[model samples]
Target: MRPSGLRHHHRLETRAVTRFEPNLRIPGPTSLPPSVREAGGRQMINHRGPEFAAMLGRIQTGMRPYFGTQSEIAVLSCAGTGGLEAAVVNVLSPGDRVLGVSIGAFGDRFAKIAEVYGAAVDRVSAEWGHAARPDEVRERLRGGDYRAVLLTHNETSTGVMNPIPDLAAAIHQESPETLILVDSVSALGAVPFEMDGWGTDVVVTGSQKAWMAAPGLAMVAASERAWAAMEIAQMPRFYLDLRRHRESARSGETPWTPAIAVIYQVDEGLRLMAAEGAENVFARHEACAAATRAGLEGLGFELFADAANRSTTVTAAWIPDGVDWKAFNGEVKRRGVVLAGGQGKLAGKVFRVGHLGSVTVDEILGAIATLETVSVTAGRPVEVGAAVAAAQRAAIEAGIARVPVAAGA
Candidate 1:
């Protein structure tokens, strides 16, 4: 008696169901805000035009406070790894001695890049879940005349953030002339970094991690000392040359064609971050991290990272015994919650939850609820809602107030 469309509408009205919402819980390429998404869809612009120059200038200025530097910022059209390569190629000459302080996989990669570029790379490695202690670094620096030392500000693979200030101080004290090159790709915006204050020479970061933008641009900060190195250091470089980037940036341009759309997204993302205030943004990340850790603890999951070294950007937890990791992940995904599996040596042992870049405590609470539900579906039943409740308390305790979804978070 009714048309197909009317019958379909009648069937939908007869039952209750909620819309599917996906939570992308990964270390990087975080979910974007609506305005950021719209900005990224803007029509292409001439790379050398005035409009692009103005936008590039704004981004360069906006990035200063987050980087805690007044030094030159080179906006390169590449991922974070490319930025690290730039740091290596532009600063040190072939056969230069380098110390790589590795806490996790990314840390190792920084060293590997230096080695590939012909530097004599020696490593001071810490256990996977722990951070590199200052004492060990101090001891190592005392023994060698290292030209530069590569450090990771945050190791997302293991969910650990190194004590940069302390490590930098130790390096300077032991080897005062050694340049401090930091890979802050996963930490800069989410965590606090003081490039000049900490005497860091080069700090490289990416657009995707905490900037709430797509994976296209790698931003690097170079101190005066680092620029001086560029004058004499002789590692072969053309495309990833910081000197070229620095020169072109004087006119608000990139060395090559830039990722125009990603810059648009970064422009909007920087605007959102500025409106939120830097301190508040840091606090929000802290609150979300605390909530995530508390929630995981409530679910009887052992955290992979050490308590004192846990990263605010991502939280890694051990996959519980008696539960199939693949099955558990599938269940979580089926419910529209996508979590990150462990990397490197932790491949089958841990799972990571990313909570940064416009992520709110409420969103984390939802993910926690999903995890609790999925755990039950996997036959590991615990008290329902306990993890969510724990997360709520932790967030509140971390000075987070309930905020609107669009309140510049």
Candidate 2:
């Protein structure tokens, strides 16, 4: 998908001063860096040409370190969900008993994919707003001989970041032979992830989240064990086949005609990300998330997720008791700040503010100011500027600047 326009220009608001641009503060399809946007609009090249190969090589090599893996990562022409499906189809055969460890919506989707493909899936679900605990998975694995264990590193729906490293360790301790598949679509780049260190067999992610690019591309990293599992897998697969992508990557190509523009976009985005350094990028996300949570709490809004397990990429908060949340989001949208309403059972109950990808401290503060305006206009109770002040204080305590350096400064 293409990016929504990101502008620094201002339009006077009669009701309240306009805070930011048309803020696309949704969970996915986050705002892209201007350079990535520029690169994506460039003329498409021959997918099979040497020029594409060299570009693909740069992207692949640059991406390996983000997931903390040296193994092969296959870039495909699909959304992040496709990467999850590829991981499923590549590892388990039909009728293979597997454990689906679910935290929220994405975890459930991963399980559904495995079941639809004929894997006998058993689910271990965590409470909504909480992460799947390692002890629970360990307890379940103790009793079952599953072929694989599915996990979501960060559950976007609930704004909970699972303890993957601890969970992976638990899985390894209990079932050494079982494959560990992770759907880290919204978490991998924006959050801390370790595929090799955590013993994750397969990890799936997308371009749209924290990669600072447009949608329509999925990146999948498979361990040697996952590749070994592909050899004996009998589940039906063609387009979502990891083997095809893996085999083609050796020649710096995809099995199908890929989204060449997105590849170019990710290459440029990764270049910018690498220049910033991964730790700094991750730290930036954490600081923004902290600021957001502090700001939201200061607005007298309760966060949806458990405080200890909140995600760094998105902060989901409950809509005030007397306000129409859907209308509130629309009001925020009207203020030129687009916030994400919740998914599944959470629809109209919670709102998400995306701080992933290319958002800045000043931009987040703008969104905060917009929320205050929307709250006041919608007649919901809020202390004017209290949230922004809390956020600014939190940022300072975190060693993050309250204001951001403007682009091209």
Candidate 3:
């Protein structure tokens, strides 16, 4: 006769066990590549030691080409919000007037940050899921004694990519002395950001999103003009000080203890991206986004963003008639896919499908398949096989699917 514990073990072994599958979807803090994930498991080192300093040096050097700048790039041990704060506090004095463009949640946060610093913030607000027009921004700036204009390059909340270059041109023409600070958290690596070329003074981004690394680290690149303004700015700061970061980074160091694990991961991610080439990396994101949009359109879902300004990182789709968003999303979750939901007023009315960073065509197609099946099961009819075909067509037309491997590989 078997022991009672042995019988229980046998019974447990006979039952179907759930296995964890890695996430292949979601906008950011995207599935890290194996190399990047492995980098984090390395032995932790002293933040002030030469090993960590060397690591920071390499990261700063790697970030230059990606940011399209020769200006100083600072790594802060905080999230994207910290980068935003650094941008604001490092460059502006109390009672300075600012014009903030708000098209989504993140943009709203910029305005709030400005207000917190005692800056008189004037908002050029637009409906969520829409891009703020350059003319509107120009018109607002004309009315105020604005010291700087803050813009969100990609409003992740609404899947809208604002026309930053155009807005930059408009701001320069109207208020050349007014600094231009951009929150590029969702767009930086996935899209082109030419800081000097575009006349942008300060640009901030996070390690997640298009960088394809774990969250916690924030990167900010500031132009010479922005740094010049920092000289007279009276806003108080210590750890988030850009000047301190710049001074230390010159010798490959940080003011405070840095997140060594995240720094290692960022280094690996940047290495992978550099190997692929920056333009190629951006093109990959564009292809994924275009395919995603095409797939969604083919399925007959209405887009929340204007077609021209849709973000190349995430796509927001309106829940169709007769399909319950709750049930549809539930099915997606049940099938091991997670999607972002609408924010603020659009909550429950729209759902976001992220196609940024390391996502591939097959993975996106799988998501489309899941979405189509769930919509159909919930009584919404999507044209059979249409989404996948459209996505394929878009990918092929963009020449992204035909990317040539490097000679060695």
The prediction achieving the highest TM-score against the true structure is: 1
Better of 1 and 2 by lDDT: 1
**TM-scores for every predicted model:** 0.94, 0.94, 0.92
Residue-wise C-alpha lDDT for candidate 1, range 1-409, written one tens digit per residue: 7899999998775432343557888988898988898899999999998999999999999999999999878899999999999999999999999999999999999999999989999999999999999999999888788999999999999999999999999999999999999999999998888999999999999999999999999999999999999999999999998888888988878889999999999999999888788888898999999999999999999999999999999999999888888987877776677899989988999999999888889889988998898777666767998989999999989998445233443
* TM-score result, candidate 3: 0.92
Q: lDDT tens digits, residues 1-409, model 2?
A: 3333322232233444465558778888988777788888999888888899899889889889888899988998999988888999988899999999888888999999999999999999999899888999999999788999999888999899999999999999999999999998998888777799989999999999988888999999999998998999998889988899888878878899999888888988888777777777777787888888888888889999998899988889887788777677777777788888888888888888888887777778888888887777767678888899999888667667322211321
- The lDDT of each candidate is 0.90, 0.85, 0.84
The residue pairs in collision within model 2 are none
User: Which residue window of length 10 is worst by lDDT in model 3?
Assistant: 400-409
Total clashing pairs for each candidate = 0, 0, 0
Residue-level lDDT of model 3, residues 1-409, one tens digit each, is 9999999999875442343763356667677777877887888988877888788888878888777899879999999999999999999999999999999999999999989989989888988888989998888888568899999999988999999999999999888889999999988888887888899999999988777788989999999998999999999988898999999887778888888888898888887777888778877777888888888898888999988899999899887776767877777777767888888888888888887766766667777776776666667667778888998888767667434122112
Error of 3 at 375 (Å): 2.1
Sorted on TM-score, highest at the top, how do the candidates line up? Answer: 1, 2, 3
